[model samples]
Target chain A: GDQVEQSPSALSLHEGTGSALRCNFTTTMRAVQWFQQNSRGSLINLFYLASGTKENGRLKSTFNSKESYSTLHIRDAQLEDSGTYFCAAGSNTGYQNFYFGKGTSLTVIP
Target chain B: AQTIHQWPVAEIKAVGSPLSLGCTIKGKSSPNLYWYWQATGGTLQQLFYSITVGQVESVVQLNLSASRPKDDQFILSTEKLLLSHSGFYLCAWSHGLGGATGQLYFGEGSKLTVL
Candidate 1:
């Protein structure tokens, strides 16, 4: 069975502060995607990386296949960034099935 | 631009009752559809996925079944629901192929509360 573990289960940040959330895989993954679930339970896909790194706005993500791990870095955190962040690892096994990490709850306060 | 829609924002049902949830994708042709469940204090668990009409694959069977009646429509149903079925259900779609195929666009989830 494939497993994805996320660290820093919860985080609190002041506006403009920064931090990183990580996901480690039990098996090699072909790619990974990060998502933020809002209060309305809508998921916003932030990043999808097959390898290396990708950046969008104040968020940056990196995936190291050889290391079987991925990281999401948030810079200049804002109150709007408060939500539950999850990382889903896509397995190359077949049909691109994904294993999700227990989300990291982030709250950026004023 | 593409959009995904899920029906019935929330529901409350008694145990042993039947249940059905639906999802539809618009502005995308034959997209890969998926159903995911999230329990309280738990992670997202993929339940089913469909690549085309009339075909669906179950990932984790929590005593529920799914069907793809049309190219853009997916239905999840159970003849008898249990308390364990209470959770948040989400509908998602992806490009279905290519390197970044994992990138998913999700719809507002449907919450189920079985009493």
Candidate 2:
């Protein structure tokens, strides 16, 4: 079984719309990090949450360690937001090694 | 704050040829380093990790090997390349401390094509 699983393998949204991406962990995680892979294949870190929620610009993320799940929300989507989003969880075993999800491909059409 | 650097932004090698990729970390000492491979439209797979110099651990060996010859450098290599080895290789590092919730910083990544 996968340690981390992401939902909606692919998503499409019109400009000005909003949507959310979710990641479910099979085990307890110490922390979660969200990233967005741009067209150039460079990954940009969106959020790093030990717990609770964090927001930046039109993006927001929440990490529920007890529930073993995390969510990334995009508001008022723009074309520039189109990319593959990934969530990785670091276990509490002190290894600091992360298990990454398969990622969610998002497309914001104008 | 720390920075990670991966070399040879892109590489192309024929099957049976040798391969090597380099990564270096700056502004951090004894950081935990990792090597990851991402296939086309697939998930990122952990290949190797190192906690300190001269000690490397293989997580998912795909006929590849890694070395941490220095405190801040990690290298991934293979004696011979396979067509299936083509993909994006990422180098990452993090602060290795218990209960220290630091984000892993990744380099620009190296794209390899084993033709």
Candidate 3:
């Protein structure tokens, strides 16, 4: 079984619309990180959360360790937000190893 | 401030050929170095990690080996390249603490094409 299962493998939103991406963890993860990979193959860190939630600009992320899930919400989407988003989780066993989801491809159009 | 650099932005090699990829992290001393690989349209998988100079650990076995020659340098190589090895290779660094407690910074990545 996959350690991390991400939902909505692909999404589309209008310029001003909003959407959320979720990752369900099979194990009890200690922390999770969200990333946005641009067209040039560069990964931009969006958020790192151990518990509770975090917000930065138009992006907000929440990590629920007990429930074994995490969600990244994108609000007021912009053209720049069009990219592939990924969530990587670290379990309680070893922090050195992080498992990544298949990723959600997001496209924001006018 | 810290910056990670991966060498040979991209390369196209033939099967059975030898290959080497390098990563260097600057401005951060004794940072944890990691190697991640992603196949075309696939998930990213951790390959190797090094916490100190001359110490390397493999997280996945894809017929590849990694070495940490210097405190800030990590190198991935193989004696023979396989078609399955073609993908995007990324180098990342994090604070000495575990990723479970801190953030991980990544480099632009290197693209490999095995023909």
Candidate 4:
């Protein structure tokens, strides 16, 4: 079974619009990280959260360990924000295997 | 600031040819190193990890092996390439145990095309 399940496999938004992407975990996850992958296949780290929420510019993310889920909210989207978004979750004990979501493809149109 | 560099950028090789990809992390010490692979349009899969010199652990065996000969350098190699090995290879480093509290940083990545 997949440890993480990401939602809204694809999305499109007009410039300046807002939307959110989510991931649900099948097991207990102690931490979660959000990433944006550009067309060149480079992954840029967006957020890393053990608990609570983090806000960075037009992006905000929240990780709920108890509920086993995480979300990334994009506000005032821009053309440069077009890319694939992924969330990875990991546990605290043992070998520390981080499970990654399939990713959400976001396209911001002008 | 710490930076991760992956070499060769991209490569095209024959099916039976040997392959080696290198990653070097500058400005950080004793970092936990990891290797991840992603097929086209697929999710990232962890392949190997190393906590210290000369000790590498395999996460998923895709006919690949990794080594940590130096504190800042990690290498992924195979005796012979397989068409299935064609994908984006990423090298990452994290402080501490790379668990709940550790944040991971990734390199620019290396792309392989095995024919």
Candidate 5:
């Protein structure tokens, strides 16, 4: 069973365009973390949301814990943003508990 | 400036052979350490985590064990490998602040191939 469901397993965007990626959880989660896995296989933490929303540069993320979902918005997409984006869900119930979605592969082309 | 490092970027071993992987975190003391695995074309799954030296907990068992020998070091090992063990292994560290747990910081990840 998939605890965390990610939408748009793959996505393509034109430079300067923008879009959003989402992760829906099967149950309430304590927090959510968005990551961009680079070609080097390093997972770069983009945003960590316990609730509400956060914005960094052109990237924005929102976590609706009560709704069991989280979203990541990319604005003015750039080529450097091409990579696999992953959403990991955490819970406050247990120690080091987490759930993950496979990922959303994004590519920005000129 | 906290930095996490996973050793042996990639490795290959045969079935029945012993295996060991290591991760080290610098600039952060007593950070929660975790081991996550991703099979090729599969979703990421957490294997184990440690909150302090000499204490570790397993989230998912894949015939592997993890240990925290020092506040800054975490290790993963198995006495016998299975082909199913081949995948990408990531090491992460997390710390709580302002009464809340923070984002997980991951290393470059170690690739394993079992024949």
Candidate 6:
């Protein structure tokens, strides 16, 4: 069983529209990190959340440790935002090994 | 202020050839290091990790092995490459805080192609 699970394995959004991605953890997680992998294959860190919500530009993320889930929201999507989004959860294990979701491939069309 | 360097960027090699990838960390000391592999269009998979010099732990075996010969260097190598070994290799390091909240920073990554 995968420790981290992401919803809507793929998504499409029209420019100026919005959508949200979610990750559910099977066990308690110490933190969650969201990343965007561009077409060029570079993984860019978006948000690293230990708890609560964080908003940057048109992107926002929330991590609920009690619920063992996290969500990323994108408002007014842009063409450059098209990429694969992954949410990884770090467990309490001493090594802090991260378990990543399969990823949500998002495409924004103008 | 820390930076990770991974090279050679990309490589192409024939099957059965030996392969080696390197990663170096700067501006940090005794950092926890990790190796992750992602197959074409696949999710990231943990391969190996090291907490200190001369101590490496294997998370998944894919005909690949890792070594932390020096405090700031981690190496991933193979005696003979397998076609299944082709993928994007990522080198990451963390501050080694007691909890998992510590963030892990990644290098530029190396892409391998096995012909």
Which has the greatest lDDT? Answer: 4
* CAPRI verdict (incorrect, acceptable, medium, high) for model 1: medium
CA error at residue B110 for candidate 5, angstroms: 0.6
CA lDDT, candidate 6, residue A72: 100
Off by over 4 Å in 1: B98-100
Runs with alpha carbons beyond 4 Å of true place in candidate 5:
B96-100
Q: Answer with 3 or 5, whichever has the higher lDDT.
A: 3
lDDT of candidate 1 over A6-101, digit per residue (tens): 989999999999999999999889889999988888888899888999999999999998999999999999999999999999876226577899
lDDT of 5 at A27: 84
DockQ by candidate, in order: 0.58, 0.60, 0.58, 0.54, 0.55, 0.51
Counting clashing residue pairs in each candidate, in order, gives 0, 0, 0, 0, 0, 0
lDDT of 6 by residue, B4-68 (tens): 99988999999999999999999988888999999989899989999899999999979899999
Q: Residue-wise lDDT of candidate 3 within A15-82, one digit each (tens)? A: 99999999999988888999999987889999988899999988999999999999999999999999
Off by over 4 Å in 6: B98-101
lDDT of each: 0.90, 0.91, 0.91, 0.93, 0.90, 0.92
lDDT of 4 by residue, A1-110 (tens): 99999989999999999999999999999889999999999999999998999999999999999999999999999999999999999885324578899999999999
User: What are the RMSD figures for all models against the true structure?
Assistant: 1.7, 1.2, 1.6, 1.5, 1.7, 1.4
Instruction: Give the winner by TM-score: 2 or 5.
Output: 2
DockQ, candidate 2, vs. native dimer: 0.60
After TM-score superposition, the amount by which residue A9's alpha carbon in candidate 3 deviates from its true location, in angstroms, is: 0.3
Candidate 5 lDDT at A60 equals 96
> B-chain TM-score, every candidate?
0.95, 0.95, 0.96, 0.96, 0.95, 0.95
What TM-score should be assigned to candidate 3? Answer: 0.96
Displacement of residue A102 (Cα, Å) in model 5 is 1.4
DockQ of 5: 0.55
| B17-68 per-residue lDDT for model 4 (tens digits) | 9999999999998888999999999899999988888999999989999999
Calculate candidate 6's fnat: 0.23
